[model samples]
Target: MSEPNVLRVEGLRVHYQTPAGPVKAVDGVSFAVRPGERFGLVGESGSGKSTIALSLLRMIKPPGRVEDGSVTLDGVELLELTDEEMRRVRLARISLVAQGAMNSLNPVKRIREQIALGLREHGAAREGRAFDTFLTELLERVGLRRGVGDMFPHELSGGMKQRVCIAMAISLEPQVIVADEPTSALDVVVQWQVIDTLRRVQSELGAAVIQIGHDMGLMAHSVERIGVMYAGKLVESAAVRDLFRAPLHPYTQLLIASLPSLDGKERLQGIAGSPPSLLNPPAGCPFHPRCPFVMDVCRTTMPPPREHRPGHFAACHLYETS
Candidate 1:
């Protein structure tokens, strides 16, 4: 039998209450991450991809709140947990590899201290030498030398700092690891190295990973399933190979087309128009303004999700009639 999902989000709606109006940051988004799955969320900036990640951990700040829906991790309702209960859940069950490694790490603390802080918080540390040995093992698991842990964050390169963050994330052996743009702002070689490290660590730890970023090419190779988000909604979701081979949604097609081809035979195409403002998103279908195949029904009524294949699904008016 197949393993059950480790994380499941249903009809999640996170909105920000601004003075001007309410911004629907994450409107009715739903997806699942199975055990040991590498799930990728891809979209343009401000598409609510990061917001969804924050909501998973109940990390939404004031003015922004998880208005509705359920986030179930290991069959527990995360939204129903109290603040203290959620705190206990954070590093022990789920951890975040935040974007911008330089900012995530403390410039004042050494790498060993930062990683040990997580272990200490979770009460996983043993006395004396045992704790030190465990810490060294964590560093080596992420491709870092044991001595590197003694150096400060400023002493390491961007990629090395990122590795430290990864090391800290898996330090607790959490079941789920959310990596938001873990490879942003790195050179091509460094990007691949970080990706490789992440893959290896996830394999070793057997943790389900949610990798959020805008680069479809990177997601294509790194994840098993891909979900395309647009204007605060999931436009399409499918296995990596199925989505790339036959994208059902126009937005998914546009995003796949935007990726540069290594063979240089295909011209890169840009999606037209800017993404809609969540404060006053378009009615019915939020992507109607930019979708070339939009119909009158698309502007008048929201399209329901349709299963185009065994595991592929999309929310588009064009698929409704198929």
Candidate 2:
């Protein structure tokens, strides 16, 4: 059976106007999310992972327009919607579990009230007992007790806050969930717990999830497909198994090499050079300066995405079938 597309992004380019000039934060990126599938976007800081996530709901702030692209969720184009229309879609259709859950929650509001706010805004019946039952079940599903909902955000621990955030994101049963660094700023155990909750929720709701993180191990463990970004552009994207086995892009190879394994025998070595500044990125391949296998052609021409292997794509000239 053909997989259903839950979200599709095409030629997505987000640029921010700064005093230095226009900074290309997300440059000509394209990817898709299938129903019930987990798609991982892995990259270092300034690689535009968060920017692309924000652009999905048309949340890019002033001077950071989505420039040119189509962000369509289940046939509805988000970029063309008005502010009011977009707001409805933000939580109901596509919700973002922002990077910092501890700070994202309102300190003064009770968890139940905050969750209710999402329910009421999304037109879910607020006066019915069925909704109340569902809310209670949601807290439990996220590993939180019902009584925790009566507590304020500040009263909950970091892990509890993250769980509350997850509950809020899925409370509306959104078709697509953008989890941007959902595990950042937490202890290892908490991170694992949050990831586990997200995994279970995605499976239960049959919703597509776009997990954004810079850590390869976390991304590998949580996602079925991985997209590697460098200097605002997608360098490689493939099935998780295929990517870990044979990464096509040099940048991807470097990222995989840098992952510290649990065996305590593997040494991690990060990529040599730092990512280029977005304000004045390198001329051709943004990763050319850092790529160990840089070719003359890579230094002068931007390589277009090509099918390096069946079902795998990369933007490196060396991997281009053409």
Candidate 3:
């Protein structure tokens, strides 16, 4: 959907303080998510994809902190909000379906109580028959039976637990849902089911979704647009089909090339080297060491992002301004 942006992140930067120095988790990453759109952030481990998700919800802890930038949701500045104000923003405006359902769910609490926690925090708590009907409709939307809510986490299967989390995330009808690897550790069939459930609820609510995952295959078909992150920066941004068909960044190209083709004819290609350490990244482009088309300029000069095609942007020495 080419609707107005529901969320906008500009010049975002997050760092983790360490004995050696700061680990630049997110460095000047910027993008916008439109209403009813599914946006994916794909990257290798430690590439700051989840960090960006947490930053959006103001969840950075003690050792880690947001150093700069702004996060605006529907024209309201999130970073400027007070703690109490931010609490209200969460669940009500932007909710998260954590990567691990076991970790997010309370073993002692019934599913209804856990979900009710969000509603209560957002001051939308319901009780008795009212809550039962709401819970039934919510769980049904995620393809679960209403009685599943009265059961404890231990009674549910892995897939059901995840579906419960999805129910919790959408229960408040948030404007944006941050799903960080929602389908992780699930079987293929269940993965598809969970994704379908998520897509259905998102469409029903017309809420934007930020899908963070390392599974390029799932992301290829799930999201409308994708942002490729490398060395704590977004190296490329484009529509899903455009990015996969014609990845501009060297890292992104290598990533796409590494995917196994369904025909089983194309040999999987791998990147030559590993990603650079953010603690002391290379002087110029972090990817120049692994880039096949590295130039003299790439060794000492960081390439500024440039738009190479309509609605596609990349940071690489290969692309010159038109």
True-structure RMSD, every candidate: 1.6, 1.8, 1.9
Per lDDT, the best of the predicted structures is 3
Question: At residue 308, what lDDT does model 2 achieve?
Answer: 69
Q: Please write out the lDDT profile of model 1 over residues 171-195, one tens digit for every residue.
A: 8889999999999998888999899
lDDT of 1: 0.89
Give the range of the ten consecutive residues with the poorest summed lDDT in model 3. Answer: 96-105
Off by over 4 Å in 1: 1-3
Model 3: pairs clashing at backbone N, Cα or C within 3 Å: none
Off by over 4 Å in 2: 1-3, 128-131, 264-268
Clashes of 2: 0
In terms of lDDT, the poorest run of 10 residues in model 2 is 123-132
Estimate the TM-score for candidate 3.
Answer: 0.97
Q: What lDDT would each prediction earn against the true structure?
A: 0.89, 0.89, 0.91
